[model samples]
Target: MLSRSSFLAVIATIAATNVVAAPFTYVNERFGTVCTFPDDIFTDRQPEPDNGDGQQWLSADGASLICSGILNIDDDTPKGFVAAEKASSEPGYKVTYSKASKDWAVLSGLKDGNIFYERRLFGRDGVIRTVWIEYPPAAKSKYDPLVGAIAGSLKAR
Candidate 1:
């Protein structure tokens, strides 16, 4: 038989596990994409009009942002991403990762003392999905993984 203290410890562990927040999947069927994000970071989400394609999430402190949207284009997915890149208005934009054939690209740069990371993916359905994550440069280590998760979660239907 287990000791009383041992049983209490096991109960505590189970309770802790239950306290952990579960992740949520945000799906936009109109754009044919799904994104998953942890429930801990962003505390508020509001629907925004993106010409019928968009969503936004705000961090608890409101210091960070995550947003996604879609744009209609006639070009193929790859070309659509390329065209979007060429049309970027960010001065001194630097591409951190890019794959034209994959129809995905990640670009980052410092703007107004804040680090801006943008991941863009073009779908075969003539819709382009873009995820933008902005946070202070000093918090890169903390936010980078979150950015990766949100971007990777995006899947075309």
Candidate 2:
């Protein structure tokens, strides 16, 4: 038998849990894209930066990072995948996963002891939307779920 105050406390806890799990959208009209992120846990790395290219963000603890942009290249997802592959082919990058579809390209790898995940979505309007999230391998358990949520929330509008 729960007392009235105890029942109210339980309700409050549930409400807070729901709010903390809610996603927030990072929108850039210039890029014609929107990405979902965790609430109040990430801070914009470039709050006043130009939206022409994209936006960058950092975890509140600075242990993780995220960024997204739209490039002006007139190409399809294959081209974007090639570009991503080229970019990740740099000195210390070791690809852990890669996949390409008609509309999406993903390249994830471990570099310099850090984990990096990148995805590119091809828009029919000749715009390439790219997103990147990075965190130390040691922090993957904490950051992976949040990053995954953000990646899963990306959409072209």
Candidate 3:
């Protein structure tokens, strides 16, 4: 048998471990569209920086309609796009990258219907930003936490 305090401790541990907060939306920018999110995270980069693999860039035209607006990825930084993706719910690698930066973000009509969303941070020098993409599409749902952190750090213009 456990003492009252011990029992409470066990319950507290379980509760603490299970507790989860909802995901937040971040600043999203486009032609004339802009939005904000607080729970999300954002980070600053050198404009020309490398996450790990490919050199990150502001590119033009890709699967993501986002490129049509302010930023673009040239030779996309390795797993940079995953900033918009979450951990593998299915079974796969922790992260993957384009053999090339051509496909910054993609929504393959593979599953049934596909949807995408994004947020951007603006600046005077250029445009520092964070973008997220989703399927059923939402803030915390399938969104990447790393991206959320990066988004949280964004300095809006």
Candidate 4:
């Protein structure tokens, strides 16, 4: 039998092990896009693309998160971007929910059987900052709650 204090200490250790790590901020140098995400959940950071657009991270369980920025060559607005996403013809791309304001747009739906959420910020610097996350439907309960925080942190630096 364990002493009372020993039992409490063991419980605390277990709880600490289960606690998720704090999020880490990622900033895109090329376009000044910024976002935050829990690095423990997205452990594998892929090589940055040669174009210096942004970064991609992958979870051990097949989920992915991408934080990127692109030149707003088309001079797109939030509303127009949302409309273009809805009309996208990419294979297995479907937008079930969408909202747009003057400076931001959000889209959420199924993509290739996985749940995907995307947020974009229209920056004054003629750049569009974006954060896109996708996870398996089976892990919705695990991931759905975190998406909002991740998306909320995406912005122009």
Q: Which regions of candidate 1 fall more than 4 Å away from where they truly are?
A: 1-21, 63-67, 74-99
Report how far off residue 65 is in candidate 3 (Å): 16
lDDT order of candidates, top first: 4, 2, 1, 3
Candidate 3, overall lDDT? 0.31
TM-score of each: 0.67, 0.73, 0.24, 0.86
Per residue, candidate 1 scores C-alpha lDDT tens digits across 56-141 of: 77765444555455665455566566566766787756444445557676666665666767776776666777767777777666
Q: Ten residues in a row with the worst lDDT in model 1?
A: 1-10
For TM-score, the strongest prediction is 4
RMSD of each: 9.6, 8.7, 16.7, 9.2
**Pairs in clash, predicted candidate 2:** none
In terms of TM-score, how similar is model 2 to the real structure?
0.73
Two-way TM-score contest, 2 vs 3, winner:
2
The better-scoring model by lDDT among 3 and 4 is: 4
**Model 2 over residues 1-157: C-alpha lDDT tens digits?**
3334533443344345444543455677676677665555565455636546667777655555454565656455655665667666578888778877888777788877788887777877777777788887777666665555556556675
- Candidate 3 or 1, higher lDDT: 1
Better of 1 and 3 by TM-score: 1
